[model samples]
Target: MINGILFRQRTGLPWRDLPACSGSWKTVHDRHRRWSADGTWERILRAVQADADTEGRIDWSMVSVDSTTCRAHQHAAGASTRAPKIPGRRRSPARHRSDEALGRSRTRPDHVGGDKAYSSRRNRRHLRRRHIKHTLPEPRDQRANRQRRGSQGGRPTGFDKTIYRRRNEVERTINRFKNFRAVATRFDKRA
Candidate 1:
């Protein structure tokens, strides 16, 4: 049943339009929803990730964390104002927009490279916990905050300028992922 759902997600098929050959689509969809609600999906994903780590599929020596905005149709927009847009057109008639769609995790080849948007304390802490080398530029707000606090603010975290150049690959990867119609359209109703 779970496999059917995975297939639907990979193929970007409407839930109601799932093929009969895959078995009862309703059963699969229901199971998927139930698992999501119960946090079973998260646990499964974590387990697989852990297993991959143990088997060496994951390179903890370097990992990247970045977010991409998957633009949605005006009809798909939610109640958020900062959502992705259609671009080029001047007017936007959508009532609500969300900037975030789905998040995908990837293993960085050597070191994680990101911009100021990823400079949050929590993100830095996560990288530290994973023991992954990273370079994330500081945001203007954080810099000002540190300056205002003087010695109390402590020194800003060191960021590698050379490694940060590699951050361009993150954007390239996002572009490649978006090449898939399913990813671009966000046909999967489930997160």
Candidate 2:
């Protein structure tokens, strides 16, 4: 059943088109719905991350954050209207306040990298508060605006060209996710 659900997710195939070898599509979907509603997937992911951290398997030297917008299919537009009324399905209290669908790290990494889109003053301030070194290049217009303010413009933001070059890795990772048709097209409408 898990295999069927994963296959469907990977291929973005409709439930009716699921292969018979993986068992009934309805059963697979039902299991997925149940697991999702119960937060089983979240628990599983947390456990895996915990185990990896305990085993010293995660790299903490650098981290990257970025966002990508996916276009939703027309069929995926209506699920938000049918909210599930399941009991005892609230989000965990331990979840980080900063969690926003982007992946999480167990520890603050030594350095962070992102694109110009994430180089806003608020974002930089947030990173500063966290003491996370960031390599986000200011957009030309923003730089010009700051310069227009003279001394009040403050010192230029620190940027490491060498580290910023690695931001391409984040872009490639997003592209890989978009390779999954369901993710790229947002087949699941519920947020």
Candidate 3:
């Protein structure tokens, strides 16, 4: 059942298209759905993360963040108005995000590395308030405007060339996720 479920998930196949070797696709689908609703998947992830942390395989010192646009299918829109809305399901999850699993962690990362797109004064202020170190390169326009302000602009934001290089870790992580068909295609309408 697990294999069947994983296969379906990996391939992003419709429930009806699942192979017969899986033995009744409905059963596998139901099991996956039930497990998902019961927080089994989240539990599994937490357990694995715990094990990795214990083994010193997971680093907690720094958190890398980057953005990548996920292209949606042309058919993503045009949903049937006749269908009832699912309560608690967000309208546009891709645009509107909620607190993620990492946000729930008790331990805060000491540092954050992000892309230039995330380089905003508000973001830096928030990070300062949180007392977390960040490595986000300021955009060219921001630099020019800051320079235009002269003394009022204050000193340039402290950026480390060495630390910024590590920012690519998040970009690589995003690329890895894109290897999954569902993530690359954005087949689902909601997210």
Question: lDDT per prediction?
Answer: 0.62, 0.73, 0.70
Instruction: Residues 1-191, candidate 2: write the lDDT tens digits.
Output: 88898888889989889999999888998888889889988777777776666666766666777777667677765553477422222221111122224354555777888888788999888888999899999999999999999999878988889888876766787777778787677565554
Model 2 pairs whose backbones collide? none
CA lDDT of 136 in candidate 1? 85
Give the CA lDDT, 0 to 100, for residue 139 in model 3. 93
The lDDT ranking, best first, is 2, 3, 1
> lDDT by residue for model 3 over 1-191, one digit each (tens)?
99888777678776668899998988997887788779888778766766665566656566787656666566565556775433322222121112245343435577888777778899899999999999889999999999999999967988988888877777677667667765566444442
lDDT score for residue 166 of model 3: 76
Highest TM-score scorer: 2
Work out the TM-score per prediction. Answer: 0.56, 0.80, 0.76
lDDT for model 3, on a 0 to 1 scale? 0.70
Badly placed stretches (over 4 Å) of model 2 are 78-106, 188-191
